[model samples]
Target: MDIAILVKLTSRAWSLNILASMNSGIPGRQAPLLAATSASRTAFAQSLDHLMQLGLLERNPGHGHPLRPEFRLTKTGAEIAQTATRIVQAVPDDTEFALLRRSWTAPILALTHRPQRFSALKSGLITISDRALSTSLQRLEDSAWIEREIDATLRHPFPTYRAVNQGFAVNQAIALVA
Candidate 1:
């Protein structure tokens, strides 16, 4: 997905509300800031549900109010949020990654040393167009060189690409031949 689109979907307005309310130790109630933007209870509920599905939000059971639930980021969700922030900051203000098919082997390999979201991987060095990035990631996945978990923690979400076991086995075989 495009970083711009991702940012819009995971806006500061939504993130702050979830983080603030959780930090404030409130149980299940929407933060005042989010409540202002939502206007209606239904809208707020829908927004909350969307975040939950993204794995960026979670609910905590309220001791007193069964209906009024507390929401917070799951570990994976928090990592994605932080990684998103890094991606935003890392991209040059004036330039979008325009090149495609340019070798991303170096950066991709480095990120594989420590699994990270696609955004984080992109942020680390190479800047390629969204399409190219997607294609490359898909190719890696198809090759069984990487695996992604649909609902991972904040520290690792989205396409947290890693060296597949098969990849390692192949590397070992190649090393032996060499």
Candidate 2:
């Protein structure tokens, strides 16, 4: 899965969680998804709508009442949902879910899989602002998901970031799908 695509899919809170829940065999109805993701009704509805707009999910025709439509993943959505499931499984607990929910965290972690400098990471996630990238890097470091190491071999030493611990697991999950 491309980082850009993943980032877009996860821009809304609970979107990834919703996909993971469905991929894990949960029923496609609203009630089950809402329960599985633990998202507020408004947020869940918005994420569901976002996914539908992206064409990753759609209303299941004739399978559910108009007031309670069921959803099914499109072909592209199923593949992405499988990746989302793996990434969710890699998270150690609910605390980490907050980090993953951030727009840049998962994409940043994925980029750090091979170790990258701040500028490199920012470039990889084209639209991220400097402050947003820096904040995300700090949060990931604080969570011990990534390590910042200063490289002295070069004439101008620079800090490099690499995924570690849970971040490594998530990166590996993304790698498997990619």
Candidate 3:
């Protein structure tokens, strides 16, 4: 499975619940499971169907009760789940850091000095939401490309940020871009 798809599925409460239930050898009761995971019945059904098509799950033969159908993971499903877990756990904390470094090249070169926030950085080169900008900043900071300082001027202040030594590489790349 694609890492992105696996990540999205694992992160969703309903999918994870279903996976966990299957892992534990308990067949999920569709309606109750959907209710517990706060997912729509249609969405839950779709996810289950997709898993089934992927050879990750199978519908158990109906027992005496025709109304209740049980679902269980195949051996391949267990292996996929294990692989997904390993991949997710192995992801670096600064997952977006490299992308952020590449993205900020132009702005970094244009700036006489580093900006205090990604909003300040984005103003010149690209349009991004405040939330996305903040996330990028956090990623850069986590990767040691930037450092944060307390801003004393703002009431109920936020941290001020500036590029660290690692940003020099980004600056150099930017200088070469044109």
Candidate 4:
């Protein structure tokens, strides 16, 4: 998975949950997927449409009702879903999994494999706003997925971030996909 693709995959809040559920052998029908991901109807529908547009998911032909169609992963989707399964498994709790659903979570985690300053992370992500980056860092720090330390060796002594524990596991999962 390229970083950009991973970004697209996690852009919708429920996209990863949908993919993980499908990878876990949950039925491909909308009702089952909604139950599995616990997503609201509109969000689930949008995510399903997003995945289909991304070429990761498609309508199943000769199966399911036209009004309530079934879906299946395309070859690329299956590959990405497998990667998503690994990431889903790496998260040890629901709270952490919820963090993973955030738009910037995976990319931030991927960037934090090595210690990096806030500016470095922000620059790496390009489009993330300062507030979003700050909020994400705070959340990841609170969850203990990452650690922040003062790099006193620098002239300005700025705080740097790095993935730790389960964050490391998630980063590894992303690397495997890459």
The global C-alpha lDDT for each of the candidates, from Candidate 1 onward, is 0.47, 0.91, 0.51, 0.90
Alpha-carbon deviation at 136 in model 4, angstroms: 0.8
Instruction: Write down the TM-score for model 1.
Output: 0.33
Instruction: Give candidate 2's TM-score.
Output: 0.96
Model 4: residues >4 Å from true position, as ranges? none
Worst 10 residues of 1 by lDDT: 93-102
Question: How many clashes in each candidate?
Answer: 7, 0, 0, 1
lDDT tens digits by residue: candidate 3, 45-102: 8777777766777776663245667666678787665543332222223443224323
In model 4, the Cα lDDT at residue 30 comes to 92
Error of 4 at 45 (Å): 1.2
Candidate 4, residue 77: CA error in Å?
A: 0.6
Give the winner by TM-score: 1 or 3.
Answer: 3
Best to worst by lDDT, what's the order? 2, 4, 3, 1
Best by TM-score: 2
Total backbone clashes of model 3? Answer: 0
| Superposed Cα deviation of residue 77, candidate 3 (Å) | 1.1
Q: Candidate 4 has which clashing residue pairs, if any?
A: 1-177
- Least lDDT summed over 10 consecutive residues: which range in candidate 2? 92-101
